[model samples]
Target: MTGESGTTRLPRQRDTTPTAQVRLLVAVGTDKHPFDRLVDWLAQWHAQAADPVRLTVQHGHTPAPGVPGGVPFLGHDALQQAMADADLVVCHGGPATILEARRHGHLPIVVPRDPARGEHVDDHQQLFARRLGAAGLVALCETREALHHALATGLADLSRYAVAADPHAHEARRAAVDRVGQIVEELVDRATRRPPRWRAWARPDRGAKETR
Candidate 1:
């Protein structure tokens, strides 16, 4: 947009989604919201909820200002702590966010933002979702319909603790314990492959010509 003095002035596109009812917390860490289009649908669903919907969007960086009920456009200091404390957490697929969600026992829904398509960088969220989803830990929503379903359902058992134990690691590969065995084998293999520094020094030097 050209200004009166011939300078360019950017136009802001406001999200027209009505926030009559919703009770969700949004956490996007420096990633464009690809699922942003679901805002209206989510808001509509929120309105149908028996309780009033209150959404708090916490942007980790300086992005465009979103619709009403949005916090500051800048990042916040207590983002993770807030997520840990929130009733329901909606966010991107990052290690920290996932870990926090698991630690707090809150069910988190990850939205992948694509930069190539002007949403986010590479599809890291896709990878995160794939790995976490396989673990039966998180709910990965790719399409808007899935996201709406997640929003309508909100989070499941949002009060649980993950102390890091092999609850499924017992026996058989198909068994829960089998997965634990896999993780243990991986750890042992990693440990045995790399000897201590003293072991490396104790090895005889084969580079020198062997004297008969």
Candidate 2:
């Protein structure tokens, strides 16, 4: 069904059909860069997977996946509703998206954009994804093989990817905001604190006399 702003609403009905068990919501965010690689991987998986899976893609700048449920963007409420209805949440390495999924009781499967592949401006996504992965906050899939494995695993046991929704969601959101801020600050400090070439060049010999 069409939602506000012409966005397609994700199907909320529980289909009793045998193939309707697994519902995936994939959001690649609304970044300027096109994340064609992730969309391509989803298409490849959907085409080849043995089971019938319901896949809804919020593709953003990426080219349409040519699938039935391909929405370019979702409004705030629509996204939240979609996430609530999804059995599995697959998304980019965006921190906000990751946290939002978690708030909805999903341990999201994340694929960080690659700067080497022109998916993003730099490797910050990769860096942040790794950090969160290390903390066991997300399932970080950096390769097609890994993503495939994650999809297969999540489909097999949906409960494995599910988390307990925080009772205090508002407090959780505040904490998430603070956590993201810390991570960004750390990343910025790491990037900016590197000794610059100018610093080395401007350093004068300790024994040298003062300039006239």
> Best candidate, TM-score-wise?
2
Residue 48 miss distance in model 1 (angstroms): 5.3
Error of 2 at 124 (Å): 1.5
Tell me the RMSD of model 2 versus the true structure.
7.6
lDDT of 1 at 44: 57
Across residues 163-199, which tens digit of lDDT does each residue of candidate 2 receive? 7665245764787789897987788578557664444
Give per-model CA RMSD: 17.9, 7.6
| lDDT of candidate 1 at residue 126, scale 0 to 100 | 59
Model 1: per-residue Cα lDDT over 1-212, one tens digit each: 44233444332222224553334666666544444443444455555656555567765443423444565433344664565445666666665566555444455776655445555545555555656667767777666677767765653322321222221222321343345345545544653475544443345664444433
Stretches of model 1 off by over 4 angstroms after superposition: 1-23, 32-50, 60-68, 72-77, 155-212
In model 1, what lDDT does residue 191 have? 39
